[model samples]
Every structure is written in structure tokens, then in C-alpha cells.
Target: MSQAPRRTVVVLAAGEGKRMKSATPKVLHSLLGRTLLGHVLVAAGAAEAEQTVVVVGHQAEQVREHLAEVAPAAVPVLQAVQNGTGHAVRIALEAVPEAAGTVVVLNGDVPLLRPETVASLIAAHESAARAATVLAAAVDDPSGLGRIVRDASGGLARIVEERDASAEEREIREINAGIYVFEAAALRAALGKLSTDNEQGEEYLTDVFGLLVEVGSPVGVFVAPDVEETLGANDRAQLAELRALLRDRVNTAWMRSGVSILDPATAWIDVTVTLEPDAVIDQNTQLKGASAVAAGAVIGPDTTLVDTSVGAGATVLRAHAVGAEIGPEAVVGPFSYLRPGTRLGRKSKIGGFVEAKNSELGEGAKVPHLSYVGDATVGAGANVGAGTIVANYDGVRKSRTVVGEAAFVGSDTVLIAPVEVGPGAYVAAGSVIAKDVPAGNLGVTRAQQRNVEGWTARRRPGSKSAAAAEVAERAAAGAGEVSEAE
Candidate 1:
């Protein structure tokens, strides 16, 4: 048996996307943290194209840089002028190797195109020994799209652009999807015959299918099972719509795998985020940048986590955490901020209105309510009370506060940096401790209280003495009236 021919993919990303109204190329616009072109490249990889070529024009340098990072395997070719899709494909085909037997053309903006669709199109074209195969779809409203006109035998005859279609042809619901797979030699020959004779004065790739039909070469059509997969974004509104669709698709997959998203509409999880089975994601939450939620954990109601890790059984509510690790069974927030380098140990609690940065809280340690713990270490079972602030930064440099195991940091206490609270130490309420406290000792720094005799009567308004004198005067008048009556 003769060996099968190698497959090559041509991705057209050169359009300026003037409709997008962005200085950035349309293909570079992000969709779920990855660019639109990135998604297309991923699908190409899934299709297992032996060689991939990208045709870039508008903002070529920017696209090339991104391609280097995301799809290094693909080669980029420049189309120096603003031309139609046909010209772009011609430029791309020049880079394809001669040994290739099949070439697939793709649009960069259609991020939802599946690899299976590409494979199926190629399979249909090869199995039927057809010269070309076009992906077609039937949309409810086909305005502004090219109508697919089939021959009497139900094979593709030609694609009629909306502006060029006659009254009868305009009513066709089957439209061209702008994706195609072709026999390599047939496509090369048809490209030479293309002309800039259309309404836009640009060579249309749709013309190739017509040329194939005229030459008596079989042309096939593959109607996508889901029309949405063929959709491409041209403007901001369409971009947003496509993003929502992609999110729904990704979120639905996670839910099917045992993740619970309380409100799917409000939960936004990036493509890089991972949620273990049984994890509950609440409404209005955004999980981004490689964050992971362990099984049985509950996150959000209004929370954002970036590059963070939530352990099993942990609960994070109304919190914003970045580059932090939350331990198992830990409780964080109704409003808490955990910054970079923060590590909350198992069973620990970072309560509401607390902010922690570059700090390590040992197992069972509790920083409950209204505290700022930064550049510090709290030992196991240590209690950092409400209104406590670790003075970790001075005028010149940042320092560290170390609280030994079982230490009690009192409410409204300020532990100045470069200080240590030893094991079993008790820091009195309202103390400002700048020096280290010995083990099992009480650290009190507040000034002693002194009583001032009659201070309230002398200095305060509405004194008790004034009220007592008024009562005595009323009693004397009553007694005098009784004596007069007698």
C-alpha cells in the first residue's frame, strides 16, 4: 500500500480586525487568559497536523512574538498588503512542503473550532477522493454570510457572497463556514487561477471551490454539528459573547467532573485553574493563574484567588488571596487579604478584616479580626488578638516579629518589629512591646493609671453634685410647707 500523505495546516491571522477597534491584532485578543490564536493553535495540535503555517500581516511583529511563546512549532509567513483570505492562503501555501498531500485552512478568530471537526473534514475529503472539502453550517440568521450553492447532485457548486447573491440564492440557510481542507496539488493549481474580480476587489478563497467544480473535480461539504463552533468574533460585543460561551463550556466540564459551582454565570475560572472533585465554588468568584482548590473546600461568595492553593476542607469567604497557600481545614475571611508569601497552617484561622503578607501562621494559630500580620511568624496555638498590628516596617527597613508557641498576644497590642514573644508569654491588652518578652512572663508597656480627686465635678459638665443639690433643695421646700401647715 502507498504511504499516506502528510497533513499541513494554514492559519490565517493577518487581518487587522478593524471591526475590533483595537490597536492590538484581533487574533491576539485574550479569551479565557489565552489569545484567540492560541486556541486555534491548540486545536491544530489536537488535529495532529504534520506542519503548521501561520499567515500574519497586521502587527506582524507582535503576532510573531506571541507565536514564538505559544506555538513555537508553527512557522509564520508575512502578507505585506491588506488582501482577502485567498491571498493570505496563497502566501501560506508557499511554505508547505511538497510532500504534503492535504492542506487545511483555518481562521484565527474562531477559537471554538474543535479538532474533531478538522479531522472529520479531512477524512471526508480523503475518503471520497475529492479535490476540496468545505465546512458548512445552517444558521437561523445568515445575513452578511456567504451562501453555499450546491449542484443538482447535492455537491458543493460555489459559494455566493451576500452582496453578489441573487434574490433566490440569498434565501439559502446553508452558509460557508470559512474553513476548508484541500488536496495539496489541486489547491495549488486553483490558487493560480484566482482573480481579484469580486465586489471587494480582493481574491476570495471561495473562488477556489468554484474553480474546482468547473474543472470537474469533486467538492465535498461537512456541515458542523454545532453551528456555534464555526462562529468568529469581529467586534467587541461578539468577542464578549464568544467568551461567555467558552466559559460555559469549560465550567460545564468541571461541574460534570464533580465540582459544584453555585452560580455558573457569576463564577469565572481561568483555563489554568484546577478544582479537585467535590470543591464548591460560590457566586461572583474568580479563580485565576494556576490556582487549585482541593476536594471538599469552599471558596468565594465574592472572592478572587490568583496563583493560590486551597487545601482540603478549607473555607475561604469574601477573600482576595494571591501567591498564598491555605492549609487544610483553615478558615479565612468574610473579608481578608492574603498577599504573597502567606502560608496559613492546618486548622488556623485568619478572620475578617485581617491582612497578612509574607507571614507564616503555624498550625492552630489564630489571627482573629482586625489585624495586620506582615513579615512575621506565629507559632502553633498562638493567638493574635483583635486590633493587633505587627509593626514590621520601620522608616528604613522591614523587620520580623516572632511569636513562640502558645503565646497570647493581647487585643490592641502593637508588637514592634525585631521583637519576640517567648513561649507561654502573655502580652497585656493595649501594650506596645518593643523588646523581647521572656517565657511565661507578662509584657505590659502602658502607663499606670492615676486617680484625680473631684476631677469629674470640676472639669466635666452635668456633674453628679449639681443634680444632688437640686434634689436636696426640693426636699427642704417640702419640709418647710409641712411645718407651716402644722
Candidate 2:
């Protein structure tokens, strides 16, 4: 059996993207949670390229740092200055060995270019034994794009950039998509002959194809099946369009895999999110950053989950949670906020307008309505009533509040930490408890209620007695009206 050819991929990512008007490099901009370059690298890996090299220049260090984190397998080569695509490719070629069988060139900003498309291009180039292959597309409006020029025999002659093309050439509907595969030896030879003879004084990669054709080398063209797959964003608006396209693709895949997205148009799920089968996602829900939604869980109508995990059979409505783990069968929010380090136990309830941070709630625990529990732990079956606040921070330091099993924390109570409500203990409503309560005991700290008779009458000109008489009169009139109507 003949051994497979060694494949190398060169990604051109050094463009400043001045049109993007961003401080960050253009290829570093995020598309569906991954950087544009990241998507390109992923596709290159999928295409089974044995060696990959990235050419970086604008904000080179920053791009290098990011590549170190996401794609350490790929080598980074610096171009040092902004010249042209040809010059960038020339720099990238230096990193590849002379024995490399085939070389694939990719534009880093073209995130939608699929791996299968690339694989097909490689196979076509090798099978046809062509010196060069270009990925071409037939678009409706090819404005501002390079047109594919063919010679007398109808072979790809050259690619004429829009600025350099004549009026007739500009009318060509078939455009070069800026992706190519080249025989390694032919590519090296072409690079050595590149000249900055264009009007812009920059070496043109398109000139390489013309050179190949002049030498009687076969040049092939692979028309992309989908024109949109070859699109690259140069501005914010285009970036958003690409993002929408990518999001739709991702969402569609999830829907086909048995996840229920009520309104895919309004649901924004990142590429990193994982949703188990039968999970129901409501409108306006954004699941991002490695979030996992389990089966039978209902999330949103207006919720955002980042790096969070929702357990099976749970309901999270209109909540925003990050770095939190919600237990099975638990109910959180109609408007709850869960911050990092929060872990809600099985069958527990975190009701409306509640916020929890760095806290753990045991199974069956209930923090129902208008509460903030931070740096705290509530044991099994404990009830943290409405309007409860665990004051976990003091002037000098932060502390923890512990509520033992089966404890009853009354409404409007403040547990000032370093305090504990023991097992089976009861905390009275409106109390400010600073000390620990013994097991099975009640903790209460409130001023005794006193009745001040006639104080309202003395304090106000319109006294309480007059108010009561007015209420009685209204009641009598209502009763009379009801009797007459009957």
C-alpha cells in the first residue's frame, strides 16, 4: 500500500484588521465563544494536517499567548511587519520542512470553512496530481472580492483582485475564496519567484497560480458547495452575521440530538455548552462556557448560565447563574442570582429575588424569597424564610453562617456571622442573632413590643377614630348598595 502524503497547513492571521477598529487583533475576536483563529485551527486539525503553522504580526505576543492556551500543537511564526498575504505565506513556508508532500493555506478569519471541505480539497489536489488547487465560489455579488480568471483553454489563469481587475474581469461571478492547496515543491518554487510588482508594492499570492500555469503545471479549481462557508468578516456587522450563522448551525445540531429549544432564534448557546437529551430550553436563554444541562431540566424564558451545571428534573426560571451546580429536582428562581461556588442540593428550592454566593444548601433545604446567602451552609431540610439575610461580611473579615439540619430560620431575620443555628433550632422573625443557638432551642433578639394607646390621634390631626368612622361609613354604604341591587 502507498503511504499517505505528509500534509502541512499554514494559517495567515497577521492582518491588523484596521476595518474592525478594535484594540485586539482581528483573528482574536470571538465567534460563538471561540476566537476566529481558534475555529480555523480546529478545522485544520480535523482535516488531519500533520503539521500546522500560524503567521502572526499585529499584536503578535497576545495572539501567541492565546495560541499557547488553545492550540499549543501549532507552531507560531512572526512576520514582524504588515506586507501582504504572499509575504505572510512566505514566512509561514520557512517553518515547514522541504519534504512536506502537500501544503494547505487558510485565512484565519474564515471561521465557517469546514474541515470536510478542506479534506475534499486535499484529496482532489492529490488525486488529480495538480500543482495547485483553489477553492472558488460563485456568489451573487462579488464586489470587493478577487475574481477567478481563466485562460484560453478555460483553465484557472490567475486571480485578479478587485482593485487591479478591468471592468470586464470585475463582472466575473466566480470569485477566488482565498483558500488554496499546493504541491509542496511547486509552492516553494513559486514563493522564491514572488515579486512586489503590483500597484500596492506588495507581493501577491494570486501571482503564484499564474506562475504555475506558465510552467505548464496543472491548476485545478474546487467550487465550494456553500458560498457562505467561504465568507470572512472584516467589520463588526459582518462579524455579527457570521456569529448568527454559526449559532444557528450549533443550535440546529443540538435540536437534532434531542434537546428541546422552544425558540432557537432567541436561544444563544455557545459552542462549548453540552445539553443532555430531553432538556427543555426556553426563549432568550444563553447557555455559555462549558455549561451542561441534564435531561428533563427546564431552563429559562430569560436565563443565562455560564460554566454552570443543571441537574436532571430541575427547573431554573429567569435566573442568572455562573460557576454554580444546581442539584436534581431543585427549583431556582423566577428571578434568582447564583454566583460562583454555589451548589444547590437535590429537591431544594431557591425562590424569587434570592441571591446565593459561595454557599452550599443541603438536600431539601429551602431559601424562599427575598434572601441573600453568601459564604454559608444550610443543612438538610432547613427552612430559610423570606427576607432572611446571612451577614457573612464584617468590617475586618468575612465569615460563614451555618444552619444545622431541620432548622427553622424565621422571616426578616439576620444571622450575623460567625453564628450557627443548631439542629432543630428555631430563629424568631425580625431577630438579629449574633451568637450560636443551642440544638433544639429558639434564638430571638428583639425589643419587646409596647402598646401606645391614642398615640396616633395625638400625633396626627386626622386621628385614628375618624379614619375608623370613615371606613365604617363606606362599609354601610356598600351594604346598602348591595341590598338595593339584589
Backbone clashes for every candidate come to 0, 0
Clashing pairs in 2: none
Model 1 stretches with alpha carbons more than 4 Å out:
1-5, 96-99, 395-397, 438-441, 450-486
lDDT tens digits by residue: candidate 1, 1-486: 997667889999999999999999999998776899998888777557778999999999999999999989889999999678888988888876462688888999998888887777788888998889899999999999999998898978899899889999999999998888898899989988999987898888989999998989988899998898999999999999999998898899999999999999999888879999999999999998889999999999999999999999999999999999999999999899999999999999999999999999999999999999999999999999999999999989999999989999999999999999999899999999999998899999999899875454567648777567557767988999999999
Q: Candidate 2: which stretches are off by over 4 Å?
A: 1-4, 97-99, 152-154, 462-486
**Residue 58 in candidate 2, Cα distance off native in Å:** 1.3
How much does each candidate deviate from the true structure in C-alpha RMSD?
A: 5.0, 4.1
Count backbone clashes in candidate 2.
0
Q: Quick one: best TM-score, which candidate?
A: 2
Candidate 1: pairs in clash: none
Task: Residues 278-299, candidate 2: write the lDDT tens digits.
Answer: 9999999999998999999999
Q: What is the lDDT of residue 457 in candidate 2?
A: 52
